[model samples]
Target: MSVEVRAVPGESLSFPGRITRVAPPRTHWAPVYRRRVVVADVVAVVGSTLFAYALRFGNAHAHPVQALLLLGLVPVAWLAALFVFRAYERRFMGLGNEEYDRVLQASVFTLALVGTTSWAFQLEIARGYVIIALPLGMFTILLLRYAMRKWLHGQRDRGLHMQSLLVVGHRQGVLAMVRQISRASYHGMRVVGVCLPPAADGRLGVEERALAALGVPVLGGLDEAADVSVSAGVDAVAVLPTPEVDGAFLRRLGWALEETHADLFVAPAVTEVVGPRVAIRPVCGLPLLHLERPELTGFRRLVKGTFDRVASGVGVLVLAPVLVGIALAIKADSRGPVFFRQERVGLEGRTFGMLKFRSMVVDAEARLRDLAASSEGNAVLFKMKDDPRVTRVGRVLRRLSLDELPQLFNVLLGHMSLVGPRPPLAREVAVYGDDARRKLLVKPGLTGLWQINGRSDLDWDESVRLDLRYVENWSFGFDFMILWKTLGAVVRSRGAY
Candidate 1:
């Protein structure tokens, strides 16, 4: 028997009877078998508890009843905690650290609950059993989850067991959503078709055309999306929300999807707000998304600043002998001073004398005007790959980025950070357009996104984009990542001249 389901834009439809038949060739136990993962977790917990019991009580010969009881309760407690923690939800599986975090939390909660219950009920549970079993169960659960995650990731990499999605929204919004999903296939969304909402402009953007060329079907307007989703056999419908998705229309769409068992997903318009930074606060009757502003002050700022100062201070102290040797090398190779200071724009557009160990001739600035016409930099900036102004010692220093080591002092003086936007010269800031001024929103750094990402090799637009992206998405974790990458970039010296 065949059943028909009716769906709408932003809604899902499923028929009462099997809407689609599964062929023998299509059936597999790898990707879509979420039940298998839960079963594996339960078995692993039970097995580990049993082993722990044996290890703690010899062969369980003296306390067979007690060992069996504890092993039996382990699975029960774990399953209960997993359900309470929503660990089995397919939506959260194989994505982000949240899934693993829940597994740990559930294990901890289960162990605590079992311990507390034994004490309160006076069950005379052996301390050896509790001590050994708890850690063993927790470690086993984490290890099993990690192994499952690796297996799932392999499946995703091979394009198996992914959810097929029907994108529905205005042409631009749908196209944007399609591009993002296609680029991040590890997220497990396969865009099967796009349902463009009726609008004045019938033409799709360049992005949409590119997606269409890649064989993603472009279904007609929203009115026809229901039929398309059913025909395409999509598992979910993601509504790429335009400004028009008000509460009333969203509610109605939810009601329409009830007949179809397909899941519904809503993509918000806000960008740069990752899961950790956004909180949904239901004020009165409206769902208000509260985005926590990037904290640049208070305890976090204090900690970051303290870390920067102490780290930079120690770096300078450890590298003092190297610094002295470099200074002597510079003097031996050229007549220039040991260090150079240039006027640069810093935080909030404040002017500062940015210091670096000298890597140019004494008359380099004077010669710059003569060589200005042949400048190879981004036009506004001045750079020459084989400039004659570089001294013998300067060449080595520049290549290894030893020239900027003195900026550790700048970080200690609060004039810079261990990580931030690249400090712009005064001349560069003068030529910056209004949009470019946003780079000064935070303190400039000695090395940053531009430095690690090919440094002088990047075009003007690309450099500015990276800098602004850093400002918008600044986090302590991101800073550490940049720092780690910087070490590798320095070793390669890809863009360091």
Candidate 2:
């Protein structure tokens, strides 16, 4: 058996006559991470329960024996419940909603079990103690998990604890997949090398040369990918969409991967569509991927609309003082009205007056024609970094996103949503293709994917892509996530003009 040196992105390694197997280094990190999470969970559970007990009983001895026993049993049962629910699974340790969802399910299960047992046995259990302890414990656990996740992501960003992937596909597909994976390194997969489909001239293609330029080595042609994967000791093999890699080829690759510890992943043709909208069902013994249409109407939409109105109404009421202060400031700083209402296309191409605190001069619109030549925005939207039309207070309001606070009223009036596509100007919508027009299916948002993502820094295609992605995969949970992230974006003030 011949030993092989470790693989690098730009440099090719030789395996000689045969390759000696070595354990994947990245796999070891997962178990270490899971152990830390387990310890953190244990500490959170015990501390929260003890704190709850102390708070509820106040060192008094009403039923000390039962309370002590209950305290001891709860932590053990909680850990058991988490394990039973597979909350400690490696796949969910570092990212995604599955880990948090599992922990929540386990906590709920533990609470129910405790309540049922106490009732069945006629055991004396304090309602206050149970209520405080369960929720406190769950919240503490989630907090610790979130901290650990951030640390893990930081480590991965620095090129640690990441799975090395050997991507096999057409050059274009491979490049697209690699770029996406690289951009989201928190997902913990790094494309170290690629195996492109063989060219007709048996020479490197332009895309292959581009990959090499980016320090991603081209291992071999498609037929040699399995052998190369094993020789390269890759943690996973990602096969992108390509006609050359058929079902039979995938089966053979899967079998080949079994010899080593590598996992095989096949990318579907539909990349933009994700989450619950796409499902795989077995039909006639073959897996068929079913794509569902976007749900713009029905009970879910009603719930979404209801949530928007309630949330925006509450927000407006709570921020009334701040809103008044902003209005006063805008009035003092500008010669125009306190609020700026611009006509923007909303749901189904309907026009509505979107509100914002006036952040520009009274004749800002009249001056737009002169600045068109120096516009720094995308093809559709006209934006200038240092436009002479902006007022002194406008910069601060725009940076902190205070100018758009008045849009909450639009949300309450059913003209906008708390989270959806950005409101487009009539001119912007005029150039829309069929795909881009899908953004009109839902109401415009006060802040959405485009805002949290680069905001004004994004080009036309990317902004439209993010909006389309949001439209394709809209849900209450998704909206909540975008709203949560929007707070951070506002604080950071990145890409704000």
Give the winner by lDDT. 2
Error of 1 at 291 (Å): 4.1
Query: Per-residue lDDT of 425-487 in model 1, one digit per residue for the tens?
Result: 887888899868988988888778887888877778768877887776777877887897799
In candidate 1 the C-alpha lDDT for residue 85 amounts to 92
Query: Tell me, what's the RMSD of every candidate?
Result: 8.5, 4.3
- Give RMSD (Å) of candidate 1 vs. truth: 8.5
Model 2, 1-497: lDDT tens digits are: 23223333454433222344322554689889999999999999999989988888896864666776568888899999999999999877888788999999999999999899899988888888889999999999999999999899999989889998989998888886776687678899988777776677655567766776666766677888888888778899999888888889999999988988888888888777888999999999999999999888999999999999999999999999999999888888868799899999999999999999999998999989989999898888888888888899999998899999999999999999999999999988898999999999998899999998878887798799899999999988888889888998999897788
Candidate number with greatest TM-score: 2
Clashing pairs in 2: none
Which consecutive 10 residues in model 2 have the weakest lDDT in total?
14-23
TM-score of each: 0.64, 0.88
Q: Given candidate 1, what's the lDDT at residue 172? A: 65
